[model samples]
Target: MLLILLFFVAMWAGAQNALAGGGSFLTLPTLMLTGMDARAANVTSCVALFPAQIATGWTGRDLSRGAAGLSLRTLFIISIVGGAVGAVILLLTPPAFFARLVPWLVLFATAVFAYGSFLRKPGEANAHLSPRGAMASQFLISVYGGYFGGGIGFLMVAALTMAGQNVRIAAATKNVLAAVMNASAVAIFLFSPDLHLAQALVTSLGATIGGVVGARLLHHIPDKWLRIVVIIIGALLTLGLFLRAP
Candidate 1:
């Protein structure tokens, strides 16, 4: 029964990630409910959902091109390196400390995404970040993606849009970059003692299907609605994290 529930949860998470980026908020709690510790749950979630990210990214590959002044190759390298750093930090972090930080991190990501999605001026939609700013933002977002990964998708969308990509392109590009960033973290987590193979496998299958579905929906959804949905999910996840925090 728990496995069945996990499959459904992973489906939703994969679609949510493809749509906007708070999928971790769902997957993390579901993993914990299945008796995994927080750290283990985080690692397992990253590992299991990774393939879905790749599928989603692949479906939108034409739109997942470079952003700002940085080529996709450069961004991929940055994501790989940053993700490794974040995975190492996660492995070293004490559970209690990570718990204390979770709410604040979600809140911060939510605010940034909100501002970028809704509050920014209309003229700013086409604004481009400096080369340094784009690289720095992507690096930090990649690190966060490798670590907890709850709101990383939204963060990437926000950063990419600010760096001059339109919303659709930003969303597609985010999926690929996110997949690249999480790949390193997944490699590190594969050896984790706490990983639950059965759970990960079930989740992976469901997420893979959902990812394909979600990627297909990308072109159908209007740009305005996409941004609105992403912002709403981020805000709700922020509230949910705060309420669930100890």
Candidate 2:
């Protein structure tokens, strides 16, 4: 049981690092299937992802120079507001809405990631949206981010591409904003009844290790292959969501 659990955790870490989206979709379902309640699964996944984001941030600090490093203050402020708003929205809404929206959102995100090549220039830096607009999009994304971060990275990447930013800058900006969403959601979970602290801790440890490895290996990986695989997974997840619908 322990080895199996660790194996899943490791796989989750790799997926999280490679895609920056859909990591939770893989791990959370596994936890639920293993007998965790749905809410607990989300809480546990959030806990695991918190450290993973932190590790990514730390390891990628030097990579954020130039355009990516500019306007971080605006990004951070927008993220906080967006995270807070998203958290409140989650507390007020029923879970059914998320179940309905997730598939569409996943498919949209997948499309954006997969088609990023055709839509933007090769190695372009900050392509289309203004900094202010980018910040606003980040805030909006935080709303979704606070509830489920599955494809948040893809959304961020798209936003950055639309804004004419380079991939590295977009990725860096996405991580910072994502960290805000994760931190805020984690805080809410800490006080909520659904959290499983023990499970969260263990999963977090695994995610941390995986994040470090992912960050270190980021440059060497084939992003095109990774994006293709994630798109297929997202499509499948979307199909499941549709099938499960009434």
lDDT per model vs. reference: 0.80, 0.65
**Local distance difference test, candidate 1:** 0.80
Q: Write one digit per residue (lDDT tens) for candidate 2, span 198-221.
A: 666666666666666665666887
> Runs in model 2 with CA error above 4 Å?
15-21, 36-40, 63-70, 117-127, 216-220
Question: Model 2, residue 163: displacement in angstroms?
Answer: 3.7
Alpha-carbon TM-score of each model against the true structure: 0.84, 0.79
RMSD, one per candidate, in order: 2.9, 3.5
Q: Candidate 1's residue-wise lDDT over 1-246, tens digit each?
A: 999999998988777666655666677778878987777888888899888877767777888867788898999899999999999999999877776677777677667666765686767666678889999999998888888776676678878888988888987898889889989999999987867899999889888777767768868877577656656766676687678766
Best by TM-score: 1
TM-score, model 1 to reference: 0.84
Tell me how many residue pairs clash in candidate 1: 0
